[model samples]
Target: MIPLSPEILAALALALLAGLVAGAWPARRRLLAQAAEAARQAERAAQLQDRVAQLERDLSAQADALESWRARAQDGRLELAQLQAAHHEKLAAFEELRQAFDQSRATLRAEFQHLAGQVLEEKSQGFSRSSQDALGSLLRPFREQIESFQRRVNEIHDASVSGQARLDTEIRRVLETGLKMSDEAQSLAMALKGDKKATGNWGEVLLERSLQLAGLIAGDHYQAQASFRDEAGNRRQPDFIVRLPDGKHLIIDSKVSLVDYDRAVSAATPEAREAALVAHVRAVRQHIDDLARKDYSSLTGMKSPGFVLMYLPIEPAYIEAMRRDRELFDHGYRHNVVLVSHTTLMPVLRTVATLWMLARSNEQARALGDQAGGLYRQVEMVAARLQKLGHALGAAAAHYNGTVTAVAGQRGLYGKVGRFAELSAKAGRPLPALEPLLADFEVQRLDGIAPGADHVPETGRADAGSPPGAVPEDLHPPGEPNP
Candidate 1:
């Protein structure tokens, strides 16, 4: 509002010019900085573009490689599938071939076994027949027993071969039957739970069957329900009395009750079963005690072992009893009682049968021994007679030889008989030619004769032409011609 002089105005103009120059310098510096920043941004953008192009190229190459691998993988998969199919077919063929081989092998084995059995049987029969024939005259005393023994041997051999062949089948059948029987037995046990007499009868039947299976005859090898009277006149009847080769007895009694065992079998719970088992064991123990009191070993006229056999009809009952009471066997043994099931008793019966066979064999051998001794004595008598006959024959031969030497010597009857033949030339038989033996002739003597025993000196001369060593004419047979 109060502008005064030109100098003041000039000063204001210089200040304004300096301010505009400062502003223009700042603007130029800002513009140059902005241009450098824009250049760096563009360079950065170019580097980014180059990296994107390289990444695109790499992606395309990888796609081509992946396609090549995929094609090879497809071919490999096809080849693998074909190989698997061939392997499976070959494996199936091998299985069929193996099965056929097994069938052929089995057929061959059966045929071989059959042929072998037949051959063995034929040979055995032939040998037995021949032995019977050879020994028939010599073994007159044992003929019947020998025949019986031979028949038994044949029966045993046949049974053995048949049993061996059927053993596998029998074992399988037994296992299957045992399983089935176990179920049936459980049911039977339930039915007979309260019937004491029925259970005893059942046990006795099984015991008899076992004896029969072991080749024991009822009247011979064993007796059923054999009654013996004790000292007190008590009629003690044992279910079976098995006879041994040594004339001893095996007493088997079938009196065990299976009622508690049946209860155990039908128990509804673990605790119930446990209780029933305990009761069953106690019942078995009680039965053992009762059987032990029978004292079958002390029966009159019977040679029995100390222990009596207590037979159980069911195998499972025996097994369960023993399983529950591990010391049950020792317990029964201490009480002179033996617990036996069918399976266990079979071996004892078989052993008894074997013993009987061995005893029969020993008896046959003893008879043979006695016969052999008699035969040896007969041979000695025959040999002595043969020696005496040889001595007589040797003496007769020496006498005949001496008489022949006397006649056939240079001074024998032939020399004088030649003149007689000339004298009787007209006789019908032209005098049978009498050729003397060679002067160096030899006479064979009996091998066993003593040196001088068979020699005989000529007693007297038959004719004047006879030699001094000639035997007497009376010693020669009347009908015999001169030597």
Candidate 2:
């Protein structure tokens, strides 16, 4: 409120200006900082907007890719379904084929069993009746073997029949196990490829199996490894000795070498096969020569034919030998040796058995003829005795009629006996009443043979109570009518 001079006011203004300037400087610094902060916020907001736009574009692209994946999945499902249906069709077709195969197999098996059973039954029935006598002992060893063979054959046939379900399962399993069998076969072939002893043993086993299949009973119909001594005192044994129906023997040799033949089969090249086949043929010829040199036919108890059977257990080996050398079989034949395979020897063994059966049948027939002759002689003696009995009976009937006529004829002992009955009553003791015999009553002759004149009247009369021409019931012989 006090009035001041101008000079004092001017000095105060200068000081106040200085103070305002200091305060304004701080405010300006604050405004400049606020403006810089606002510019940074706007730039950050622009960057955020650009980021949102990029994210939306990315989201849209992902949604389109997702739709494409959904469509591709739908097409894949359709394709998979089609493939599955095709697989099912093929499976159904295969199943039908397998079922048909099983049905056919079953039908064939049933038919085979029926036919074989009929043949076996007929043969067994014939053999049974024929074996009841002396032949029984001869065939005893064979019966059990034949029955066992038949049972094994039946079991094999039964085992061969497989159901459809089993067939399916086996089909699936065979895929896994089939290669294993092939591997085993290869291993076996390798084992026997170069080994001579093992091959020979296998051949011998095959020969024995063939013998069994041919229904030859060992030790009965055939002897295995029967020993014989030559004139030089050397013991020789044949693989098998078949007993012929004529009491002779058949020698079979199973020691044929097949090493070269196995090599021929496994040969890779045609030239190698040719070389191996030539060696096989040479080996076969050598074996034939060896058999012929042994001369089993001349052995003491062999009784074999001029020819000895050289058994080649493998059919292919025999065929290969013959094919390579056309004259191989002829060569063997010339040397008194015959080359035979399993197929050929089976028929020979069967023929020997047939011959034995026929020989036994002839013996049984001869015995039957002798029995028939004896039966006829016995019948003749019985007829003579029956004739003599008839004659004696006729004579007895005549004697009986004569005694009856003497005792009970008119004015005979019966009338006298009737008078004695009254005397017996007067004596207080009744006599036994004697019945009278009729004059027409007579005994009939046996078999309608005419009786003696004293027994029967010249004119024929009916026998006591019998009709004319009727014989007594007890007098008729079996199966014969009365005359």
The sequence of per-residue lDDT tens digits that candidate 1 reaches over residues 1-483 is 896799998999999999999889989999999999999999999988977875796577457545643554464345435534643553344343333333433443354344334433432343455644653453343334334433543444454445434433433343234335445555677888669999888778767866775668899999999888988998999889999887889989887888888887788865677788799899999988888777889988989887899987776677778777989999999999999865556546655765675465455444433433333233233233334544454465567667765666578766666677667757556534434222221112212111232332222212335432122232223343222
Per-residue lDDT of model 2, residues 332-375, tens digit only: 99999999875456556645654664465445334333432332
Candidate 1 stretches greater than 4 Å from native: 1-184, 361-394, 416-483
Among these predictions, the greatest lDDT belongs to 1
Measured by TM-score, the strongest candidate is 1
How many clashes show up per model? Answer: 0, 0
lDDT of 1 at 171: 30
The true-versus-predicted C-alpha distance at residue 33 of model 1, in Å, is 86
Which clashing pairs does model 2 show?
none
